[model samples]
Target: MTAGVQATVNDASGDPLGAHVALVIVVVMVFWAFLVAGLMFEPYRQFGHTGRLLQLTGICHLLTVLQDSRSWSLARVGDVASILMLGLLAHLILTLPQGRIISGRRRAAVAGMYAGVVAATAVSLRYGPGFDAGCDCFPPGPELSAAAQRGLLYGSAAFFWAYGLILGGVLIWRLLIRPHPAQRRSFSLAALTGALTIVGVGGRLGLFVMPGTPAPDGPYAVVYAATLTTMVLGPLGLVTVVVRARMHQASILDATVGDQGLLPPSELENALATVLKDPTVRLTGHPPVEPGRSGVPLRIAGDHVVHLTYSSALDGQPELIRSAAALARLTLRDDHLRAELADNLEAVRASRARIVQAGDAERRRIERDLHDGAQQRLVSLAARLGLALLQLSRGQHATATATVTAAVGELQDALEELRELTRGLHSPVLENAGLAQALASLAERSPIPASVMATGERLAPAVERAAYFVAAEAVTNAIKHSQAQRITITAEIRNARLVLTIQDDGIGGARATGSGLSGLADRVAALDGRLTVTSPPGRGTALVAELPSPPHDLR
Candidate 1:
């Protein structure tokens, strides 16, 4: 076990560069397979050519890499293989998307490209200098001068890339003139692939054209680097095209599933037509007929039709005429009841949320009434008690003076307690002014130094009440239990929700289930809001609450 653990650690700490390159190569191979699979399974036969050519291209590139493992003399065989692949690529580009060649002239041009590659490879094997010794004895071979061999190599390189440039021009033209959006997307991918391959070709041509110029690396190195880069990116380009096509298909399916029951019958027909990609799609519901005599018929324009029969149990029900799209019947059949139930469930949830909000509003109203009415009256009573005590203290009734003073003190205490209770219930500032002012009042009243940072448009009354209560409870708990030096309350409105957070710098370990915090949570819940308290040992407590706030226009 110890040795295994040490080995695992060593593997985990292995050189990252080799691991990364391996991962990239594996991903590229997977993407190559995905692209080929997407093409091979395409619905149309016209795309078969491009898919087959790409398959050949992938094979040729793989062989090129494998050639590096062979002896250099044997590796020369890959030259013609590489040239044939490029010729095939040119053909693929010229006839992208629907891969059938458009005209005889275009077909002839593709044939000429392949012919040129074959002739050049033949010339190189015959008249050109050989890489291995066995070729010295071959008969009927032209013995070319070194300079002539160099010129032949340069000429071949130039011709190959010039053909590539022409193919690139054809791809660009197709992209510009293609009328269908789907075909244009495929053309775009073909164009990008062509461009990258052309760049690599141009790099090779550069070496041939400048024999006297010193290369940054050896010829083989530059060619291999360019080839590897194209191999990696070409698969990615094809995969992008495949992904986009699948996404478009998925969107159609998604629309069918989502809007089946929502649209009117005529509108639903149009929607189905869009999803099925057949504009002629229509629906015609029929009255119940003899159970087996004549069933429902589903037809796609210019395609074979299918008849669906109703069971004896469903004989009395109206016949649903589903769209020709596969699975459309399943979506449309008996969906009304499900849609109605869904709407009812949503309405119930909304109603419950409103009731919770109304409770919070009622609480705020009571708090406001208590503060402005009864609390004010009590304040006046406290003033009267103080006046009576002052008068008795002046010696009008010496023995009763002490009793009045004590009673006056008690009244003063009651007034203070009432003020605390009203603040806790709901801040008068929150009702009249806004949440910011209420939070500021809270910060001022907190035993520890506290600050309020709030911004954004004023929220609804219920939202304000919920936020105020949570902040008050959190502040009270933090000051009472947490030996905090300071507290901070932050409030903001975002995406029509009021987010309020309170934090303290003190000994932590506050629990959400504590009576004060739990009651705060209940108040928040009554407003369809959420409250969370987070405190860890040695980390100060924090409380966050989120409340739904309708738009100002809505309010």
Candidate 2:
């Protein structure tokens, strides 16, 4: 560290006449080196462009040292280099934060400045001396006529002045009007740097337009001081801009990382806006879909309206946003994914609890049905048969026969009730006849006119069972509550999963958390399948179930 300081001190005093310019160049070079090093190790490149501009801004000042030297060739080269540097500075200020040109107007401005610089260089090469009289760098060249020299030099001057004024005006306008605090700060700094650099450099270049005039020697110290001051201040302002931008981004990430999965949508939006320094950030969600969707939701960030396209980074991963606008997008996407996972976990817990509760309730219902319906009938049948035997012993044959007939009828009713209870517990038909036949039978039995469209060879037993139960429950719910005229059931194998959909043309107000649908969801969940219910009142109810095929079934 001591050695580094000593090196810096030596560099600053290397040329006493141009000491300040040398120091400014060193400071900017050091800033650039650190920026590049950080960019190499850091994952984010939010200030990559700004770093490059600072480096270029510093390198341009090297020509200042060259302008002071006695070598005519070096001085001529320095003049042309300075012209190029002016254009570069304009380009840098106009395209801040992000390095690339943003709008057509800014693009045209940069293009015009570049064209002006090129024209100026071409004319200077044609008219100016290639070398001094005693120098052996190049053969002496014929000078252009005074008229031609003035025209070329004056035209070039006009170009530089125009670029400086236009760029400075734009920055000033932004500083005055832009509502965002960060943007206003950027514009303000840029305007100050631009004003200083333009006035200082443009003034120096203006003197060269007159034909056969030598640049001032010593009395113009004020001009040299102004030029050095602007060069020094420009990089300092840039350093501040880079630091502030990085801090803003880091603060946003810190706030977000703390709340991770807990922020409600509104708070999340606010957090994002605060971090991005854009008060107008918005987020939107796309529901899970089959065959997927083509587009992502629309969100506005600062001055840019972005359509976050959906793409997956890897197989079996959730779809992620494709955005290049800001560093905040990375954190924002991560927070969203974390929140979604949290919600799904909560839903799974609730589903499990409901499943346990529903299972207990179902067991009690079965017990009650047996005790009230079949058990009572069986007891009555036993009593009547006993009476029949007693009457037969008393020789009343006709009465005994009538009692026996009544007993038999009671026995048959008891058998039917037990069979129904058994069917409810586990369908024998579904076990024996497979999915298609069972669903067909279900459609046949429904009170509402129903149709079944199932097409698959055979799925895993668990998958088939889950699919069948989903269809059965949905149909029963539609028949009982929907007051519908028609029901449609569709089952197909898609992407190695059994997909089933049940729709009813009735009053549509079914909720996934409702008792009946909730139970069906548990059944589907057990098989690692998902069930979604869409019921719009007065429109229709649609229930969809997707069950993954077991490994053997896939084979």
Best by TM-score: 2
Tell me the whole-model lDDT of each prediction, alpha carbons only.
0.60, 0.64
TM-scores, each model vs. reference: 0.40, 0.57
Model 1 Cα lDDT, one tens digit per residue, 457-552: 577777777788778878878878899999999998778778899999888998877656656776677676778888998889888898877776
RMSD of 1: 23.8
Q: Give stretches of model 1 more than 4 Å off.
A: 1-46, 66-77, 123-140, 145-151, 175-179, 182-190, 202-214, 218-227, 257-265, 268-555
* Cα lDDT, model 1, residue 19: 38
- Poorly placed runs, candidate 2 (over 4 Å): 1-83, 93-112, 115-181, 187-194, 208-217, 220-222, 225-233, 253-417, 436-491, 494-555
Candidate 1: pairs in clash = none
